[model samples]
Target: MLIHGVALMALAVAALLAAFSSIQKAGWLAAASVAPVLAVAGVLAAWAAAIHLTGGEKFDDHPWV
Candidate 1:
């Protein structure tokens, strides 16, 4: 989960940069295309972090434990 979260966050950051560049260069269509990816990845990353952090204690049995 942690790894997944990290990966997703990285993707979100990249998408955000791309979206910004698209907007700055007057490429609204490209920006619009990447918007959903940005939103979904950003939200899922947050959710993964929250689940991992709150799922159990330090000694609990889990994949990342």
Candidate 2:
């Protein structure tokens, strides 16, 4: 999970840089495409980190069983 988070964060950073470069060279259309990609990467990284910190137990755990 830690590794996954790290990888996702790295991807997010790369996407962000690409977005910045695209905006500078092209226009809003290029940057807009990158925005969602970066956002998803960032969210995935956060979710992975949270799952790792929570000891792999999700909210759906069958504790009553």
Candidate 3:
């Protein structure tokens, strides 16, 4: 779970950078690629929030300590 969250964050960062790059060098179609990236980021963020709100331990049923 820990690794999953970190990986998601990394993906989001990569997506953001790609989106910025596309916008700088391409046009509307390239910019459209960013929508999926943003969606992934949103989903990951929501997942993280759900885990936090439900008590972090619930993520994979393991206690921090």
Candidate with maximal lDDT: 2
The residue-by-residue lDDT of candidate 2 on 1-65, one tens digit each, is: 66765665576567667656777787877668766676666566666666665566656768787
- lDDT per residue (tens digit) for residues 1-65 in model 3: 66666665566566666666766777768678775676567567656755655546534555765
Encode model 1's per-residue lDDT on 1-65: one tens digit a residue: 56765665576567666556656675667567666666666566656556565642365478876
User: How does each model score on TM-score?
Assistant: 0.46, 0.52, 0.47
lDDT on C-alpha atoms for all candidate structures:
0.62, 0.65, 0.64
RMSD values, in order shown: 6.6, 3.3, 7.0
Candidate 2, position 55, lDDT: 61
Alpha-carbon deviation at 12 in model 3, angstroms: 0.4
Cα error, residue 19 of model 2, in Å, equals 1.1
Clashes within 3 Å, all models in order: 0, 0, 0
State which candidate, 1 or 2, has the greater TM-score: 2
